[model samples]
Target: MNKPFADKLRKIASYVPGEQPQCAGRIKLNANENPYPPSPRVAAALRDFDAATLAFYPDANAHRLKNALAAQNGLKASQVFVGNGSDDVLALAFQSFFCSDQPILYPDITYSFYPVWCGLFRVPYETVPLGADFRVNPRAFDRRSGGVLLPNPNAPTGIGEPLALLEDILRHNADCVVIIDEAYVDFGAESAVSLLPKYENLLIVQTASKSRSLAGLRVGWAFGSETLIGTLEAVKNSYNSYTLDAVAIEAAAASVEDDAYFRKTCKQVMDTREASAEALRALGFSILPSQANFLFATHPQKNAAELFEALRAQNIFVRYFDLPRIDNYLRITVGTDAQMARLTDALKTILS
Candidate 1:
């Protein structure tokens, strides 16, 4: 009897996240995490939070956090849905909008989690291959399908498509819900949130993990029409009413309120990313134009796998995917200026 249950479980392939090495003194950059500390307001909120509240259940609706996000994006409270992370919000969106016989579509080279979610929900999905330039072909999504799921400033590639192309896809698929994963949008990519008022079928999902330096808190949210958001809330409620805890609610709200800190940190990352890209180019790497906090590049003379190991030997970690079309590339996350200098210096020694 147990064998039958195990057999069913074996069919699902899970998402593999970037490596989190345990050893001390490692310059970890494989995961696209913010190298800077979170906003001062976040710290203040955490320090001031009452521990007695922990004994009681948190606000099931997360009203304060939702309202802050709504005011930021110019959406009503009813149009926003908060979750444990973007992954949780996306999972709920799949359940809410993608339970159909038709197949959903996403880029062949995109965030690895999309296919995992499709598998978990048993939602039918198709892959639309990116062009030779590693850019999503909006025209490919113009045909019939269950729905569309896209990551602006696509991971590993770190390339972003214009809003016009994204709008084209939205216009083509009016019958099904379209989800735009903007996990990297804050870096430079144009957001699909501005298009939310025009398309009820559109859903924009974002995370505080990358920009807010709050990956530890695991707060993510979505913006959409009230009807779509309500559907997600219903699905989320059916599963777990209190996805966000009291501390997360307070800290995330505080982070949002400090717009000055958010902008300053984002600018810092962007500056470092540009500087790193130049350094890699000077070392003979072909880098993509990234709008994310990471640079995707390949060296002409050095093998990517070999370079990855060489960097690891020096205790500098960057992301290397063995997947097709991306196996030759390394996705380097932008860290502090001093950290990036160390990475570039290590690469120079390795390449020599």
Candidate 2:
């Protein structure tokens, strides 16, 4: 610990990102990013991008991005709030909706970011344990809280809570916000967006990273009632007035409009994911049922740490965590057919 560092920053543990090895180029899959590229329209918009526009500040409200997002989700512009990325939206969300003195509730094995965000925002939270099958039990989350936040199709586990179950949880805690982080929803799971009008306290946050293949542009948005958006806007404005730049605004809006491209790519990933899951099962891995572009699996007898390293040695990168419950498992991102073939080949050889 450095003596000059602020005492507050000293105690917090930073969020660990998915590995990004420079030389692991061809079959790169660690990050759960879209294997497909963004729509051609995104590039078209970028090619015609005016250099003169950089001279002025961008729309701080990200009105263009907001409107596009609103149209796509059937929400009003005021109900949409765009941020640099979903992580930024989440960061602001922690401060805006979850800063209450009461302890927040979340699945213990959920996204690692929740705990990190809590510490970063000086918010106290309690983690509810997942049931024996490693699934989030909504009944266990029965607690008095400032709010609840979790990833649908939960990260690393790749399992989703059914809509009816989630709504029951929402009904149980109407006073506080219930945030559904649907970063990977398009892979298969139904979105909680449709439930928005019914639950004003529900905030559905999504990213352009996974399903939209625009991770580099850093676009994320949240949809809720105007009041919730108003709270987030106030927090965001105080933090950064111009979060979304001109290029990002244009690209994200254009990407949302290209439904054909997005839908096609999503279908490809889901199909490939099903094929890969079957192959993993045949090779002795127990895979969680997933509705995302990644698989959470572990070999019944093999060490996950060893498998992660073995694949990395062959330039095939995947995510492995040494935490409780998931230590034996690996989170493998869905890549193209050719990439998956190579991954399976590496696993076959290593396990042989």
Best-fitting candidate, scored by lDDT: 1
TM-scores of all predicted structures: 0.98, 0.97
Candidate 1 residue-wise lDDT, 1-352, digit = tens: 4575675554889999998898888998899999999999999999999999999999999999999999998889999999999989998999999988999999999989888988888999999999999998888898889889999989879999999999999999999999999999999989998999899999999999999999999999999999999999999999799999999999999999999999999999999999989988999999999999999999988989999999999889999999998898999999999999999999999988
Deviation in angstroms for 96 in model 1? 0.9
RMSD of 2: 1.5
lDDT of 2 by residue, 73-135 (tens): 888999999898999989989889987899999888988889998887888899988887877
TM-score of predicted structure 1: 0.98
**Considering every candidate listed, which one attains the maximal TM-score?**
1
Candidate 2 ranges with C-alpha deviation above 4 Å:
1-9, 24-26
